[model samples]
Target: MDRMSAQKRRESVIRAAIAEFARTGYHGTSTAAIAKRVGVTQPYLFRLFPDKKAIFVAALMRSMDDTRLAFERADDGMEGGGQALRAMTGAYAHLMSTCPETLLMQMQGYAAVAAAEAQGDDLIGEVVRAGWMRIWETVHLSLGADADETASFFACGMLGNTLTAIGLPASAGR
Candidate 1:
Protein backbone atom coordinates (compact mmCIF):
# COMPACT_ATOMS: atom_id res chain seq x y z
CA MET A 1 0.00 0.00 0.00
CA ASP A 2 3.03 2.22 0.02
CA ARG A 3 3.35 5.20 -2.31
CA MET A 4 -0.19 4.72 -3.55
CA SER A 5 -2.22 7.67 -4.73
CA ALA A 6 -5.21 8.94 -2.77
CA GLN A 7 -7.63 7.20 -5.13
CA LYS A 8 -5.71 3.97 -4.73
CA ARG A 9 -5.77 4.34 -0.96
CA ARG A 10 -9.49 4.94 -1.10
CA GLU A 11 -9.91 1.74 -3.11
CA SER A 12 -7.87 -0.14 -0.55
CA VAL A 13 -10.04 1.24 2.23
CA ILE A 14 -13.15 0.08 0.37
CA ARG A 15 -11.70 -3.42 0.07
CA ALA A 16 -10.83 -3.46 3.75
CA ALA A 17 -14.29 -2.25 4.66
CA ILE A 18 -15.83 -5.10 2.68
CA ALA A 19 -13.88 -7.67 4.64
CA GLU A 20 -14.58 -6.01 7.99
CA PHE A 21 -18.23 -5.33 7.38
CA ALA A 22 -18.73 -8.78 5.88
CA ARG A 23 -17.72 -10.34 9.18
CA THR A 24 -19.66 -7.93 11.45
CA GLY A 25 -22.39 -6.43 9.26
CA TYR A 26 -23.03 -2.66 8.96
CA HIS A 27 -23.97 -1.78 12.56
CA GLY A 28 -21.57 -4.19 14.13
CA THR A 29 -18.47 -3.02 12.27
CA SER A 30 -16.62 0.19 13.13
CA THR A 31 -14.64 2.66 11.03
CA ALA A 32 -11.67 2.22 13.31
CA ALA A 33 -11.51 -1.47 12.54
CA ILE A 34 -11.69 -0.73 8.84
CA ALA A 35 -8.93 1.84 9.14
CA LYS A 36 -6.81 -0.64 11.06
CA ARG A 37 -7.36 -3.19 8.34
CA VAL A 38 -6.20 -0.60 5.83
CA GLY A 39 -3.18 0.27 8.00
CA VAL A 40 -4.39 3.85 8.36
CA THR A 41 -5.80 5.98 11.15
CA GLN A 42 -9.54 6.27 11.64
CA PRO A 43 -9.36 9.96 10.78
CA TYR A 44 -7.63 9.03 7.53
CA LEU A 45 -10.51 6.71 6.78
CA PHE A 46 -12.90 9.57 7.45
CA ARG A 47 -10.86 11.61 4.98
CA LEU A 48 -11.44 8.83 2.44
CA PHE A 49 -15.13 8.43 3.34
CA PRO A 50 -17.53 10.89 4.92
CA ASP A 51 -18.68 8.41 7.55
CA LYS A 52 -19.32 4.79 8.44
CA LYS A 53 -22.48 4.50 6.37
CA ALA A 54 -20.67 5.89 3.37
CA ILE A 55 -18.04 3.23 3.73
CA PHE A 56 -20.72 0.58 4.07
CA VAL A 57 -22.43 1.87 0.95
CA ALA A 58 -19.18 1.80 -1.00
CA ALA A 59 -18.49 -1.76 0.07
CA LEU A 60 -22.05 -2.80 -0.74
CA MET A 61 -21.87 -1.32 -4.22
CA ARG A 62 -18.53 -2.91 -4.92
CA SER A 63 -19.78 -6.32 -3.86
CA MET A 64 -22.75 -6.07 -6.16
CA ASP A 65 -20.63 -4.83 -9.02
CA ASP A 66 -18.30 -7.75 -8.59
CA THR A 67 -21.23 -10.13 -8.60
CA ARG A 68 -22.45 -8.59 -11.83
CA LEU A 69 -19.06 -9.09 -13.38
CA ALA A 70 -19.11 -12.73 -12.39
CA PHE A 71 -22.33 -13.29 -14.29
CA GLU A 72 -21.13 -11.28 -17.25
CA ARG A 73 -17.92 -13.21 -17.51
CA ALA A 74 -19.73 -16.48 -17.25
CA ASP A 75 -22.07 -15.70 -20.09
CA ASP A 76 -19.94 -13.43 -22.23
CA GLY A 77 -20.22 -13.90 -26.04
CA MET A 78 -22.67 -16.72 -25.53
CA GLU A 79 -26.30 -17.00 -26.53
CA GLY A 80 -28.82 -16.98 -23.70
CA GLY A 81 -29.88 -20.52 -22.87
CA GLY A 82 -29.77 -23.25 -20.25
CA GLN A 83 -26.06 -23.72 -20.80
CA ALA A 84 -25.40 -20.07 -20.08
CA LEU A 85 -27.46 -20.32 -16.93
CA ARG A 86 -25.51 -23.38 -15.85
CA ALA A 87 -22.23 -21.56 -16.47
CA MET A 88 -23.42 -18.57 -14.46
CA THR A 89 -24.60 -20.77 -11.63
CA GLY A 90 -21.30 -22.61 -11.59
CA ALA A 91 -19.43 -19.31 -11.53
CA TYR A 92 -21.59 -18.13 -8.63
CA ALA A 93 -21.01 -21.34 -6.73
CA HIS A 94 -17.27 -20.87 -7.16
CA LEU A 95 -17.59 -17.28 -5.96
CA MET A 96 -19.49 -18.40 -2.86
CA SER A 97 -16.88 -20.96 -1.97
CA THR A 98 -13.93 -18.64 -2.49
CA CYS A 99 -15.37 -15.30 -1.32
CA PRO A 100 -17.78 -16.20 1.42
CA GLU A 101 -17.24 -12.78 2.91
CA THR A 102 -18.78 -11.27 -0.21
CA LEU A 103 -21.89 -13.41 0.28
CA LEU A 104 -22.14 -12.17 3.88
CA MET A 105 -21.78 -8.58 2.71
CA GLN A 106 -24.74 -9.07 0.35
CA MET A 107 -26.88 -10.29 3.24
CA GLN A 108 -25.83 -7.36 5.40
CA GLY A 109 -26.59 -4.85 2.66
CA TYR A 110 -30.18 -6.10 2.32
CA ALA A 111 -30.81 -5.84 6.07
CA ALA A 112 -29.17 -2.44 6.41
CA VAL A 113 -31.09 -0.99 3.50
CA ALA A 114 -34.37 -2.35 4.83
CA ALA A 115 -33.70 -0.94 8.28
CA ALA A 116 -32.77 2.46 6.92
CA GLU A 117 -35.91 2.53 4.80
CA ALA A 118 -38.02 1.61 7.79
CA GLN A 119 -36.61 4.62 9.62
CA GLY A 120 -37.71 6.90 6.75
CA ASP A 121 -34.24 7.11 5.29
CA ASP A 122 -34.29 5.99 1.68
CA LEU A 123 -30.94 7.25 0.44
CA ILE A 124 -29.02 4.10 1.33
CA GLY A 125 -31.89 1.99 0.14
CA GLU A 126 -31.84 3.73 -3.22
CA VAL A 127 -28.09 3.41 -3.60
CA VAL A 128 -28.09 -0.24 -2.63
CA ARG A 129 -31.11 -1.02 -4.74
CA ALA A 130 -29.56 0.55 -7.79
CA GLY A 131 -26.57 -1.73 -7.45
CA TRP A 132 -28.91 -4.67 -6.90
CA MET A 133 -30.91 -3.82 -10.00
CA ARG A 134 -27.79 -3.76 -12.10
CA ILE A 135 -27.01 -7.28 -10.99
CA TRP A 136 -30.63 -8.30 -11.49
CA GLU A 137 -30.76 -6.85 -14.97
CA THR A 138 -27.53 -8.54 -15.88
CA VAL A 139 -29.02 -11.86 -14.85
CA HIS A 140 -32.39 -11.04 -16.40
CA LEU A 141 -30.85 -10.33 -19.77
CA SER A 142 -28.53 -13.28 -19.55
CA LEU A 143 -31.47 -15.54 -18.78
CA GLY A 144 -33.19 -14.54 -22.06
CA ALA A 145 -35.30 -11.73 -20.56
CA ASP A 146 -37.66 -14.12 -18.86
CA ALA A 147 -38.99 -12.42 -15.74
CA ASP A 148 -39.81 -15.64 -13.95
CA GLU A 149 -36.41 -17.10 -14.77
CA THR A 150 -34.65 -13.97 -13.51
CA ALA A 151 -36.70 -13.95 -10.32
CA SER A 152 -36.09 -17.63 -9.69
CA PHE A 153 -32.33 -17.21 -10.17
CA PHE A 154 -32.19 -14.36 -7.69
CA ALA A 155 -34.39 -16.22 -5.22
CA CYS A 156 -32.08 -19.21 -5.26
CA GLY A 157 -29.04 -16.97 -4.95
CA MET A 158 -30.56 -15.21 -1.94
CA LEU A 159 -31.40 -18.51 -0.30
CA GLY A 160 -27.84 -19.68 -0.92
CA ASN A 161 -26.48 -16.50 0.63
CA THR A 162 -28.75 -16.89 3.64
CA LEU A 163 -27.64 -20.43 4.23
CA THR A 164 -24.00 -19.49 3.76
CA ALA A 165 -24.28 -16.53 6.14
CA ILE A 166 -25.90 -18.75 8.73
CA GLY A 167 -23.10 -21.32 8.34
CA LEU A 168 -25.33 -24.00 6.90
CA PRO A 169 -24.67 -26.30 3.99
CA ALA A 170 -26.64 -25.85 0.79
CA SER A 171 -28.02 -29.33 1.36
CA ALA A 172 -29.34 -29.00 4.89
CA GLY A 173 -31.05 -32.39 4.96
CA ARG A 174 -30.10 -35.93 4.06
Candidate 2:
Protein backbone atom coordinates (compact mmCIF):
# COMPACT_ATOMS: atom_id res chain seq x y z
CA MET A 1 0.00 0.00 0.00
CA ASP A 2 1.14 3.52 -0.71
CA ARG A 3 2.26 5.48 2.32
CA MET A 4 -0.40 7.77 3.75
CA SER A 5 -0.08 11.52 4.23
CA ALA A 6 0.41 12.73 7.78
CA GLN A 7 -3.23 13.80 8.03
CA LYS A 8 -4.43 10.52 6.50
CA ARG A 9 -2.12 8.50 8.71
CA ARG A 10 -3.30 10.35 11.77
CA GLU A 11 -6.93 9.85 10.85
CA SER A 12 -6.37 6.21 9.93
CA VAL A 13 -4.79 5.54 13.29
CA ILE A 14 -7.60 7.30 15.10
CA ARG A 15 -10.26 5.24 13.33
CA ALA A 16 -8.42 2.01 14.02
CA ALA A 17 -7.90 3.12 17.58
CA ILE A 18 -11.61 3.72 18.03
CA ALA A 19 -12.43 0.30 16.66
CA GLU A 20 -9.93 -1.24 19.03
CA PHE A 21 -11.20 0.71 21.98
CA ALA A 22 -14.82 0.01 21.16
CA ARG A 23 -14.21 -3.70 21.03
CA THR A 24 -11.72 -3.94 23.86
CA GLY A 25 -12.60 -1.06 26.15
CA TYR A 26 -10.06 1.66 26.92
CA HIS A 27 -7.97 -0.42 29.31
CA GLY A 28 -7.99 -3.59 27.23
CA THR A 29 -6.83 -1.99 23.98
CA SER A 30 -3.10 -2.05 23.37
CA THR A 31 -0.90 0.07 21.13
CA ALA A 32 0.17 -3.08 19.33
CA ALA A 33 -3.44 -3.90 18.69
CA ILE A 34 -4.13 -0.46 17.24
CA ALA A 35 -0.94 -0.50 15.15
CA LYS A 36 -1.71 -3.96 13.79
CA ARG A 37 -5.20 -2.88 12.87
CA VAL A 38 -3.85 0.24 11.20
CA GLY A 39 -1.28 -1.84 9.25
CA VAL A 40 1.50 -0.03 11.01
CA THR A 41 4.03 -0.96 13.68
CA GLN A 42 3.92 -0.13 17.38
CA PRO A 43 6.64 2.50 16.90
CA TYR A 44 4.63 4.01 14.10
CA LEU A 45 1.62 4.16 16.34
CA PHE A 46 3.72 5.87 18.97
CA ARG A 47 4.93 8.32 16.36
CA LEU A 48 1.33 9.22 15.75
CA PHE A 49 0.41 9.13 19.43
CA PRO A 50 2.71 9.13 22.40
CA ASP A 51 0.81 6.28 24.09
CA LYS A 52 -2.51 4.49 24.38
CA LYS A 53 -3.98 7.32 26.43
CA ALA A 54 -3.05 9.72 23.66
CA ILE A 55 -4.70 7.45 21.11
CA PHE A 56 -7.83 7.33 23.26
CA VAL A 57 -7.82 11.11 23.48
CA ALA A 58 -7.34 11.41 19.72
CA ALA A 59 -10.26 9.08 19.06
CA LEU A 60 -12.38 10.90 21.64
CA MET A 61 -11.69 14.20 19.91
CA ARG A 62 -12.76 12.74 16.56
CA SER A 63 -15.98 11.45 18.15
CA MET A 64 -16.62 14.90 19.63
CA ASP A 65 -15.98 16.49 16.24
CA ASP A 66 -18.56 14.15 14.72
CA THR A 67 -20.99 14.97 17.53
CA ARG A 68 -20.51 18.70 16.93
CA LEU A 69 -21.22 18.27 13.26
CA ALA A 70 -24.39 16.40 14.13
CA PHE A 71 -25.63 19.42 16.06
CA GLU A 72 -24.53 21.82 13.35
CA ARG A 73 -26.38 19.86 10.70
CA ALA A 74 -29.37 19.40 13.00
CA ASP A 75 -29.65 23.15 13.42
CA ASP A 76 -30.04 23.73 9.72
CA GLY A 77 -33.57 25.20 9.17
CA MET A 78 -34.72 23.95 12.60
CA GLU A 79 -36.73 26.62 14.42
CA GLY A 80 -35.84 26.31 18.13
CA GLY A 81 -34.11 24.35 20.83
CA GLY A 82 -36.71 21.61 20.87
CA GLN A 83 -36.54 21.16 17.11
CA ALA A 84 -32.79 21.40 16.92
CA LEU A 85 -32.53 18.97 19.80
CA ARG A 86 -34.91 16.54 18.15
CA ALA A 87 -32.89 16.61 14.97
CA MET A 88 -29.64 16.18 16.85
CA THR A 89 -31.03 13.44 19.08
CA GLY A 90 -32.37 11.61 16.06
CA ALA A 91 -28.96 11.65 14.46
CA TYR A 92 -27.29 10.48 17.66
CA ALA A 93 -29.92 7.83 18.35
CA HIS A 94 -29.53 6.48 14.85
CA LEU A 95 -25.85 6.11 15.49
CA MET A 96 -26.57 4.25 18.71
CA SER A 97 -28.95 1.83 17.05
CA THR A 98 -26.70 1.12 14.11
CA CYS A 99 -23.45 0.98 16.06
CA PRO A 100 -24.23 0.21 19.64
CA GLU A 101 -20.61 -0.50 20.45
CA THR A 102 -19.78 3.09 19.72
CA LEU A 103 -21.28 3.50 23.15
CA LEU A 104 -17.81 2.60 24.41
CA MET A 105 -16.48 5.69 22.69
CA GLN A 106 -19.25 7.74 24.26
CA MET A 107 -18.44 6.32 27.68
CA GLN A 108 -14.75 7.10 27.40
CA GLY A 109 -15.53 10.63 26.36
CA TYR A 110 -17.88 11.02 29.30
CA ALA A 111 -15.26 9.68 31.65
CA ALA A 112 -12.86 12.28 30.32
CA VAL A 113 -15.44 14.94 31.04
CA ALA A 114 -16.09 13.68 34.55
CA ALA A 115 -12.39 13.62 35.35
CA ALA A 116 -11.93 17.07 33.88
CA GLU A 117 -14.72 18.42 36.01
CA ALA A 118 -13.15 17.08 39.21
CA GLN A 119 -9.71 18.51 38.42
CA GLY A 120 -10.85 21.64 36.60
CA ASP A 121 -9.70 20.18 33.29
CA ASP A 122 -11.98 22.03 30.93
CA LEU A 123 -10.87 20.60 27.62
CA ILE A 124 -13.14 17.54 27.58
CA GLY A 125 -16.14 19.23 29.19
CA GLU A 126 -15.64 22.08 26.74
CA VAL A 127 -16.64 19.76 23.92
CA VAL A 128 -20.01 19.05 25.54
CA ARG A 129 -20.36 22.74 26.50
CA ALA A 130 -19.69 24.05 23.01
CA GLY A 131 -22.38 21.91 21.43
CA TRP A 132 -24.89 22.99 24.08
CA MET A 133 -23.86 26.63 23.68
CA ARG A 134 -24.87 26.48 20.04
CA ILE A 135 -28.20 25.02 21.08
CA TRP A 136 -28.60 27.82 23.57
CA GLU A 137 -27.90 30.47 20.94
CA THR A 138 -30.25 28.88 18.44
CA VAL A 139 -33.02 28.69 21.01
CA HIS A 140 -32.41 32.24 22.30
CA LEU A 141 -33.60 33.70 25.62
CA SER A 142 -37.19 32.62 25.03
CA LEU A 143 -36.22 29.24 26.48
CA GLY A 144 -35.45 30.98 29.78
CA ALA A 145 -32.00 29.39 29.96
CA ASP A 146 -28.89 31.39 30.50
CA ALA A 147 -25.72 29.85 29.08
CA ASP A 148 -24.82 27.95 32.25
CA GLU A 149 -28.27 26.52 32.76
CA THR A 150 -28.59 25.63 29.09
CA ALA A 151 -25.27 23.82 29.10
CA SER A 152 -26.28 21.91 32.22
CA PHE A 153 -29.59 20.92 30.66
CA PHE A 154 -27.87 19.65 27.55
CA ALA A 155 -25.19 17.78 29.49
CA CYS A 156 -27.85 16.15 31.60
CA GLY A 157 -30.46 15.57 28.94
CA MET A 158 -29.39 14.72 25.38
CA LEU A 159 -25.83 13.67 26.14
CA GLY A 160 -27.06 11.40 28.89
CA ASN A 161 -29.43 9.48 26.60
CA THR A 162 -27.02 8.61 23.83
CA LEU A 163 -26.26 5.09 24.98
CA THR A 164 -29.76 4.49 26.29
CA ALA A 165 -31.15 5.03 22.80
CA ILE A 166 -29.64 1.75 21.69
CA GLY A 167 -32.36 -0.88 21.09
CA LEU A 168 -34.96 1.89 20.96
CA PRO A 169 -37.59 1.38 18.30
CA ALA A 170 -36.73 2.46 14.77
CA SER A 171 -39.19 5.29 15.20
CA ALA A 172 -36.84 6.87 17.72
CA GLY A 173 -34.23 7.52 15.11
CA ARG A 174 -36.74 8.72 12.56
Candidate 3:
Protein backbone atom coordinates (compact mmCIF):
# COMPACT_ATOMS: atom_id res chain seq x y z
CA MET A 1 0.00 0.00 0.00
CA ASP A 2 1.25 3.44 -0.88
CA ARG A 3 1.69 5.80 2.03
CA MET A 4 -0.31 8.98 1.84
CA SER A 5 1.64 12.22 1.47
CA ALA A 6 1.28 14.95 4.08
CA GLN A 7 -0.92 17.02 1.78
CA LYS A 8 -3.20 14.05 1.08
CA ARG A 9 -3.40 13.26 4.77
CA ARG A 10 -4.26 16.88 5.48
CA GLU A 11 -7.08 16.78 2.96
CA SER A 12 -8.45 13.61 4.54
CA VAL A 13 -8.28 15.28 7.93
CA ILE A 14 -10.29 18.26 6.66
CA ARG A 15 -12.96 15.97 5.18
CA ALA A 16 -13.18 14.02 8.41
CA ALA A 17 -13.33 17.24 10.41
CA ILE A 18 -16.24 18.47 8.32
CA ALA A 19 -18.27 15.35 8.99
CA GLU A 20 -17.47 15.28 12.67
CA PHE A 21 -18.02 19.01 13.11
CA ALA A 22 -21.29 18.84 11.22
CA ARG A 23 -22.57 16.18 13.60
CA THR A 24 -21.24 18.01 16.66
CA GLY A 25 -20.38 21.67 16.86
CA TYR A 26 -16.79 22.81 17.37
CA HIS A 27 -17.09 22.86 21.13
CA GLY A 28 -18.59 19.39 21.12
CA THR A 29 -16.13 17.76 18.76
CA SER A 30 -12.72 16.43 19.78
CA THR A 31 -9.48 16.22 17.86
CA ALA A 32 -9.42 12.54 18.69
CA ALA A 33 -12.70 12.02 16.91
CA ILE A 34 -11.47 13.85 13.83
CA ALA A 35 -8.23 11.93 13.80
CA LYS A 36 -9.98 8.60 14.30
CA ARG A 37 -12.39 9.38 11.49
CA VAL A 38 -9.44 10.15 9.22
CA GLY A 39 -7.59 6.97 10.24
CA VAL A 40 -4.76 9.03 11.65
CA THR A 41 -3.17 9.44 15.05
CA GLN A 42 -3.81 12.55 17.11
CA PRO A 43 -0.22 13.59 16.64
CA TYR A 44 -0.57 13.32 12.89
CA LEU A 45 -3.72 15.39 12.97
CA PHE A 46 -1.98 18.00 15.08
CA ARG A 47 0.88 18.06 12.67
CA LEU A 48 -1.59 18.99 9.92
CA PHE A 49 -3.59 21.41 12.07
CA PRO A 50 -2.36 23.22 15.11
CA ASP A 51 -5.54 22.48 17.00
CA LYS A 52 -9.28 21.78 16.77
CA LYS A 53 -10.15 25.39 16.00
CA ALA A 54 -7.82 25.34 13.02
CA ILE A 55 -9.53 22.23 11.69
CA PHE A 56 -12.97 23.74 12.19
CA VAL A 57 -11.94 26.95 10.43
CA ALA A 58 -10.65 24.94 7.47
CA ALA A 59 -13.88 22.96 7.23
CA LEU A 60 -16.02 26.10 7.51
CA MET A 61 -14.03 27.89 4.83
CA ARG A 62 -14.33 24.87 2.56
CA SER A 63 -18.09 24.75 3.03
CA MET A 64 -18.36 28.43 2.16
CA ASP A 65 -16.18 27.96 -0.91
CA ASP A 66 -18.39 25.12 -2.08
CA THR A 67 -21.46 27.31 -1.75
CA ARG A 68 -19.81 30.21 -3.61
CA LEU A 69 -18.69 27.91 -6.41
CA ALA A 70 -22.19 26.53 -6.84
CA PHE A 71 -23.60 30.02 -7.23
CA GLU A 72 -20.83 31.05 -9.62
CA ARG A 73 -21.38 27.97 -11.75
CA ALA A 74 -25.11 28.54 -11.87
CA ASP A 75 -24.61 32.14 -12.88
CA ASP A 76 -22.14 31.36 -15.65
CA GLY A 77 -23.45 32.47 -19.07
CA MET A 78 -26.78 33.39 -17.52
CA GLU A 79 -27.93 36.87 -18.42
CA GLY A 80 -30.05 39.26 -16.32
CA GLY A 81 -30.61 39.42 -12.59
CA GLY A 82 -33.81 37.38 -12.51
CA GLN A 83 -32.30 34.53 -14.48
CA ALA A 84 -29.17 34.46 -12.39
CA LEU A 85 -31.13 34.60 -9.18
CA ARG A 86 -33.32 31.69 -10.18
CA ALA A 87 -30.35 29.67 -11.29
CA MET A 88 -28.55 30.40 -8.07
CA THR A 89 -31.57 29.41 -6.03
CA GLY A 90 -31.91 26.16 -7.90
CA ALA A 91 -28.21 25.50 -7.44
CA TYR A 92 -28.51 26.11 -3.71
CA ALA A 93 -31.46 23.79 -3.45
CA HIS A 94 -29.50 21.13 -5.30
CA LEU A 95 -26.56 21.69 -2.97
CA MET A 96 -28.80 21.44 0.06
CA SER A 97 -30.13 18.11 -1.13
CA THR A 98 -26.93 16.62 -2.46
CA CYS A 99 -24.46 17.92 0.12
CA PRO A 100 -26.47 18.27 3.29
CA GLU A 101 -23.29 17.84 5.26
CA THR A 102 -22.02 21.13 3.93
CA LEU A 103 -25.12 22.90 5.15
CA LEU A 104 -24.95 21.15 8.48
CA MET A 105 -21.34 22.18 8.85
CA GLN A 106 -22.32 25.75 8.09
CA MET A 107 -25.02 25.69 10.74
CA GLN A 108 -22.55 24.27 13.21
CA GLY A 109 -20.10 26.97 12.30
CA TYR A 110 -22.67 29.64 12.99
CA ALA A 111 -23.41 28.19 16.40
CA ALA A 112 -19.74 27.95 17.17
CA VAL A 113 -19.26 31.56 16.21
CA ALA A 114 -22.09 32.70 18.42
CA ALA A 115 -20.74 30.75 21.33
CA ALA A 116 -17.25 32.03 20.73
CA GLU A 117 -18.46 35.61 20.56
CA ALA A 118 -20.44 35.27 23.77
CA GLN A 119 -17.26 34.12 25.46
CA GLY A 120 -15.28 37.07 24.08
CA ASP A 121 -13.36 34.98 21.56
CA ASP A 122 -13.52 36.61 18.14
CA LEU A 123 -11.19 34.36 16.19
CA ILE A 124 -13.79 31.91 14.99
CA GLY A 125 -16.32 34.62 14.36
CA GLU A 126 -13.81 36.61 12.36
CA VAL A 127 -12.92 33.68 10.16
CA VAL A 128 -16.55 32.64 9.67
CA ARG A 129 -17.64 36.19 8.85
CA ALA A 130 -14.89 36.52 6.27
CA GLY A 131 -15.91 33.26 4.63
CA TRP A 132 -19.54 34.39 4.65
CA MET A 133 -18.60 37.65 2.96
CA ARG A 134 -16.98 35.75 0.09
CA ILE A 135 -20.23 33.89 -0.52
CA TRP A 136 -22.15 37.13 -0.19
CA GLU A 137 -19.92 38.90 -2.67
CA THR A 138 -20.25 36.03 -5.14
CA VAL A 139 -24.03 36.12 -4.96
CA HIS A 140 -24.14 39.90 -4.87
CA LEU A 141 -22.15 40.19 -8.09
CA SER A 142 -24.06 37.39 -9.77
CA LEU A 143 -27.36 39.14 -9.09
CA GLY A 144 -26.29 42.38 -10.75
CA ALA A 145 -25.02 44.06 -7.60
CA ASP A 146 -28.48 45.17 -6.48
CA ALA A 147 -28.25 45.45 -2.73
CA ASP A 148 -31.92 44.80 -2.10
CA GLU A 149 -32.03 41.80 -4.37
CA THR A 150 -28.89 40.37 -2.80
CA ALA A 151 -30.24 40.92 0.69
CA SER A 152 -33.53 39.31 -0.21
CA PHE A 153 -31.76 36.35 -1.73
CA PHE A 154 -29.70 35.79 1.38
CA ALA A 155 -32.72 36.34 3.64
CA CYS A 156 -34.58 33.58 1.84
CA GLY A 157 -31.56 31.33 1.92
CA MET A 158 -31.20 31.83 5.69
CA LEU A 159 -34.87 31.00 6.11
CA GLY A 160 -34.29 27.83 4.15
CA ASN A 161 -31.29 26.99 6.29
CA THR A 162 -33.26 27.59 9.46
CA LEU A 163 -36.11 25.39 8.31
CA THR A 164 -33.74 22.64 7.25
CA ALA A 165 -31.87 22.80 10.55
CA ILE A 166 -35.14 22.31 12.40
CA GLY A 167 -35.87 19.16 10.42
CA LEU A 168 -38.57 20.83 8.36
CA PRO A 169 -39.07 19.44 4.91
CA ALA A 170 -39.06 21.66 1.85
CA SER A 171 -42.70 20.74 1.28
CA ALA A 172 -43.74 21.44 4.85
CA GLY A 173 -46.33 24.04 3.92
CA ARG A 174 -47.62 22.31 0.84
User: What overall lDDT goes with each candidate model?
Assistant: 0.87, 0.64, 0.87
Off by over 4 Å in 1: 171-174
Q: Each model's TM-score, in the order given? A: 0.93, 0.66, 0.92
Model 2 clashing-pair count: 0
lDDT of 2 at 154: 56
For model 1, the local distance difference test gives: 0.87
- At residue 57, candidate 1 shows an lDDT of 88
List RMSD in Å for every model shown: 1.7, 4.9, 1.6
Question: In model 3, which range of ten residues has the least summed lDDT?
Answer: 165-174
In the range 1-174, model 1's lDDT, one tens digit per residue, is: 669889999999989988999999888998889999999998888888998988998998888888999999999987897977998988888888888887788778888987999999897788778988899889889989999988888878877887888898644511
Clashing pairs in 3: none
Q: Which candidate comes out best when scored by TM-score? A: 1
